[model samples]
Target: MANSLPVAVLFGVYLGIVTGIVPALVAWTLGFLFRYVVGVTIPGFGVLVLGISLAGVNGGLLALADPTIVATTDAPTIVTALLVVMMLTLYAHSRGDALGAALPRGAVAWRAIGERTLSVDLAEVFGSEVRIAVEGPVSDIEGFPPLSADTRTAIRETDWRLSADLPIDELQRRLADRIATEFDCAEVSVQIDDRGRASVAAAPELAGVSRRLDAGQRAVSVDALVPTGLVRGDRVTVRTPAETVDGTIVSARSGDPDEPSTAEPVPHSGAATTTGGEGRVTVGVSRADASRLLAVDRAAVIVRSRGRSREIELLSVLRRAGHRVRSVTLGADPPATVADLPGTVLAAETPDGWTITPAADHPLAPDQALFVVGSPETLARLGEVAR
Candidate 1:
């Protein structure tokens, strides 16, 4: 039976209070627990929808049980009940969220429930103690030539001890210097890892008499009787029937071509042998003097006496003062002149030859290299600018 509008409205409000309001309260309780206990949020609209669904089921059950009790099952009555539940659910959920945010975190409750709290110390994790040592034979770096077998073996056999606190870049540099000096390498590149492994790429120093040649110097071999105890780098004067030519002995081997050449100058004592022997002695001399020396088939060599050199002393002093010499190659668009560089230009190697202590304004070309002397900091800055 259809009821009056006032009675129908009253029955709808009562039905909403019994079914919708209770379900809305249950939904609000679930939202509050999720936010405060689990540290997660349940949307107010989700709770509202759930409460409306529960209210529809409750209303359907009430109608099935007794059709006369509901008084009205119209769309307006159902919408009104759903609206009431939605507003109340949304309001309660918002209040729950506010309370959850205002309270302290749920870690205390977790501890009370016998769950462990996870914590990490960043410094302890990242700041590990470093221990550096030479582990095995040094390997080659890519894009560079490999080191000789002898050099690699020597480096591996030697006892290398580095400070555990040294930076990686410093370690690499010191290792490179040590390898270059001990093994007589012309070029060296070093890389080291945190595990104390080293990779070394090196080029052996060029061998033979041509490496010692300077600008305007020529090596000419002549059939001559060299003075006894004569070795490479000794100043000598060759006397022929026509003229006398001054030169430095590059190599002197008596008849035996397989004998090893010696460059170290040996001291002459009173008991030393003085007799001259027939051999082919390669002498480094000026272009004009080389022509004169080469024209003669036979000559007699007289060793010239020399005093101590000051250049070696200067180099030692400079090394003790922490000065270093580093070579840098220029690119296509290089710095204008020697003056534009950071460190002092000791010398510059050009297509022509080497220029010692070149002037400030000397022009630089592509692929030319400059030997600079400075502290490590200056050299590093120069490298950055060059790159």
Candidate 2:
């Protein structure tokens, strides 16, 4: 009976109650979020109110159009039908409504809206529906939770529940400027937790000065817009600070601290009221290299520090093939077996595996794969003779 006619009718009735609410709740939330979150003035509040009224009127008219009303024997049949529907709902719920088990769950999918009537599966969203929030002003959503970038990209529900990562506080600050352009709130608002579950809070708070400062540089870091595939061990030189890569991409980086650097040392003597904190820093040079790092943009300054030196980092640079006596390394090494110690160089080629030679330049890292390259005779000879 869950997917049967009775269940569908129940679903429709439930839809009626919520569909009756969709426009009003949406309009109010949208308009309210717009004024409060986006902080922009928009004309949709009137349209929302009107649309809600229209939807309610239309829903009521549709309800009245039911032919069963005319077929009823008693005068109270209309209300009686409604009450009976309610009683059946309670009965089904008591029986663990099988149809209700098939309803949608979790966050709303904003893109799905304007296509389907949201909340058709009432129990799916009745107490736990995904909220599609038209983000707006702090004042608009006085009690709603703030939005964040982390939350927005993860939204995946039919409700188009209004937000991804847009924390409540942020929605209020940024909502207004959006309406005039999109004629709709550009973003949505939702609250998410660490386990990836999303649910609604009563309100998003306004951002105060202290909050802004608290969220200051990290917020900028969070949305830094840095190029992808940026990893650790990368030969990074600042493009904005200067036009060159620090070590010119000798090795690609692949590790932690992926945020943009805000390493400018604070000044004690700059004017207290100064707005633009502009200064010059020159890095990695014996004066000549410093000039090389600096180009024309005075706005771009190289950051200097004590150990900001430039040199080839040769822990494990590259493998040499088709050309090798022993092994290449940071320092020269004496001839010895590859198993001798830390600086042993591995000789190339043979049936009997090649042994590493002890050398001064041998790289220190243990995980380095032995690179062998050279003429066949020389390779075979070393493979046979080097011990």
**Number of the top-ranking candidate, with lDDT as the measure:** 1
Overall lDDT per candidate, in order of appearance: 0.68, 0.34
Q: How many clashes show up per model?
A: 0, 81
RMSD of 1: 19.5
Q: After superposition on all CA atoms, what RMSD does each candidate show versus the true structure?
A: 19.5, 29.5
Candidate 1 contains a number of clashing pairs equal to 0
In model 2, where do residues sit more than 4 Å from their true spots?
1-19, 41-49, 68-387
Q: How well does model 2 score by local distance difference test? A: 0.34
Give the CA lDDT, 0 to 100, for residue 331 in model 2.
22
